[model samples]
Target: MKTHIVFGESGGSSLRLALKDHQTNENIVVVVDDLMWGPIGNILLETVQEERIKWWEQVLNEEDKSDSIAYLRNTYKRLSDWTIALTGNESFLFWVGDSPTEYTGLMFLLANIPKSIPVSIIMVFPAYYKRYGRFKPLSAGEIIPEKSSILLKMQNPFLHGLEKDT
Candidate 1:
């Protein structure tokens, strides 16, 4: 069966809600990480883990440090396992938004995803240009699978560079 994986910030709850609302036939996997504004190093396994631990330590309170660390480790483990399982599967979609964190996640996926697996990326624009001339930035929680059709389609970053060809 095809699987639809949604990568975003906010601990995956919003994506899961959105996917549940959309009622898709495909199995869904949500990878949530708020990497938008943080210190990120090379995407190597060790570097990524060290950077994440450092970042979490700085952001989380001393009392919550242990719990937060455990959560981060578990989340990363789940994401890694899911990525591995999805390889060679013909059907998969990566739903990402236009943000530093989301973009980083996209790059990571592109680097690791199997070349044989055809992955479609739906890039959600940060803001909507209203007809009345107001630009409204969308909240990360606002994106839902039901509204995915309106999102921009970009060439797979693995095959094509991150630049948008005009």
Candidate 2:
């Protein structure tokens, strides 16, 4: 089975709809917390996890879910477990956009998962944006859900000694 890992919830949701349209049984894992903004050290450790939760609650200006939801608080732990539980038969297709959050999430996934597991990435970007003779970066949310099927054909190799499952 191939699991699709995405950074934000919107990106994950869009990719899920795309996968449904493409008629695939791929599972989606949405990393809600923005790793780019938070202090990431040892997420598996309970003490660090508490510090991050407190950071989110007190530092970030958002409604606190640490005290309200049990499952939500252990987001990193769940991701870590998911990564550890991946079998040799399972593959990963990371839907990465041009965002720091995606980059961090991808790094986390790469670090945790075994090197034997095959990997692929869908790099989303704006088609028409031109900035200083360079294409502007885009997030997965910017990708058209209808074009996901076609985009699958354009998946790029996440090369770092990683290759797609043959």
Candidate 3:
């Protein structure tokens, strides 16, 4: 009955928090499993409900780094469909990589998602990270203010919620 998916480089934080909140309110149940990134994965596992955990175990079995990412994409594709079927109405609030230009799979799926399904897509503004040689998270709006650029071209599906700093 709940539809929420979060992806990205630290982009999953908002989605994870929303899931936790929903669980607390007894409105929904969450299964938490994440692609290994860093400390965030550990924190998420500890915080998410045990019953909702659906981890991509194949990633662990793969020796190649690219294979792991591929497994993640395939896993989500399968899970997304299952989640939609299990719940009658389908709604997805996914926060993927701050920039779709960098994350090809996320961009492809978002664009190619069936329009007939009445799916709601929200792409969170990217927050710069230190690992990318930046000391802090930077907004795509700030980095590339030009509206002509592809980065700023996509309209946020859930603009109202984003206005409040979700």
Candidate 4:
């Protein structure tokens, strides 16, 4: 099955639904951190990760944001372990939107994902018109459920002929 790595829970939920609609039984992994605005020093290191979490906590507290940043700990570990355990039979598709957080997540995965596994990316861009209000998607998660199956049609070049029917 294809392991889809997407940013945040909303994206994960939406993608999950889309995959179901297309009769695809792919797995969805969500990385909840908004890595766009925080410390990047030794980000993969355990200590540095703790420090980064602290920084996020401080920022949230200062801004009176009620959401807790503690989820980062589990999410980081889960993502790390998942990627490291990937086998050659599995494939991946990273959904990227025109946003810093999405780019950051994409870069992180690209840097660590093993070369043995087939990898692909889905780039989401905004389409807009000034003359009249037209339909546009800000992110992959924002895609309407009924139309989301279109994203699944994207081909993974690395697995064009290697795909197995499971």
Candidate 5:
């Protein structure tokens, strides 16, 4: 199975949703850090429950069993194999009140990724304005550049989802 690691500020969730099904049965590991002084989302953990109420409502409405929850847990467990076993270390990570440059955990985790499997990295930021800004997606052959490669940037669907609010 190929491995894809996307890390950046402002568009982590958008990255996940875009890459999740890139390859069938591919394992996806998404880690979000606090974006206030650091990376992306700035909501407080204490208030995240209330803030995420709408998200939870959608989740509950979309998924109908504990197994759905279990699937995520199992997928995450597999991520450790690459980080711990391969890298031989771990650290306490705090996303809340941190800056994107401060964590740098993704760099460590990514260093351990086996080269045998295909891999790619994406860095996103808000371009233009919040309402319409997007992290342009890289086209096939562009993500992993080689001879005769053509790189193209595509629109992010998560940003498209935000169109509803606009």
Candidate 6:
């Protein structure tokens, strides 16, 4: 059986929807992280430790500190485990938007995965118009629930390489 891993922010909702509605035979693993909006100077935990501490101090109260820290640690582990599981044999796809946050997430994944593991990126823009009509580019959440069928039907989908724009 072929396994296709899809990674994105917001818990890979869009990718999950696309796979569920279309590619039922393939095993799908979704790695969702909000790394794009956070302080990610480096993919290494050590490099981002200071930033993480600062963020925790600023955003979390004393009562919530322990719980929040634990949550972050757990999330980091999950992200690391899933990312490391992307071998060259399994297909990989990254769904990202044209935003700094999304781009940062994509960069992080690109840096972590081995060069031999070919990665395909689907870039979502904020403003796009269809041939039949004009519509604003939808966010991942909006697109998944509203237009997943369209995504499933897409042929020759425009995919970019990880090396091109990073």
Put down candidate 3 lDDT per residue, 12-71, tens digits, no spaces: 344344445444321221222332322222222223212223343333554654565555
lDDT of 5 at 34: 18
**Better lDDT candidate (1, 6):** 1
**Stretches of candidate 5 above 4 Å error?**
6-25, 32-78, 81-103, 126-166
What's model 5's TM-score?
0.30
- TM-score list, all predictions: 0.62, 0.73, 0.38, 0.75, 0.30, 0.63
Model 6 earns a TM-score of: 0.63
- How large an RMSD does model 3 have? 12.6
Clashes of each: 0, 0, 4, 0, 7, 0
What is the lDDT for 130 in model 5?
29
Q: Rank order by lDDT, top first? A: 4, 2, 1, 6, 3, 5
Model 6, 57: alpha-carbon shift in Å?
5.0
Sorted on TM-score, best first, the list reads 4, 2, 6, 1, 3, 5
Clashes of 1: 0
* Comparison by lDDT, 5 against 6, better one: 6
- The candidate 1 region of ten consecutive residues with least summed lDDT is 127-136
Candidate 1 TM-score over all chains jointly: 0.62
Error of 3 at 36 (Å): 18
lDDT assessment of candidate 6: 0.53
lDDT head-to-head 4 vs 5, winner: 4
**Clashing pairs for predicted structure model 6, backbone only:** none
| lDDT by candidate, in order shown | 0.56, 0.67, 0.36, 0.68, 0.32, 0.53
Q: Name the TM-score of candidate 3.
A: 0.38
Model 4 poorest 10 in a row by lDDT: 124-133
Model 6 over residues 60-163: C-alpha lDDT tens digits?
78888877677666656665565556565754555555566566667776675566555555444432234223554434444543364454333233334455
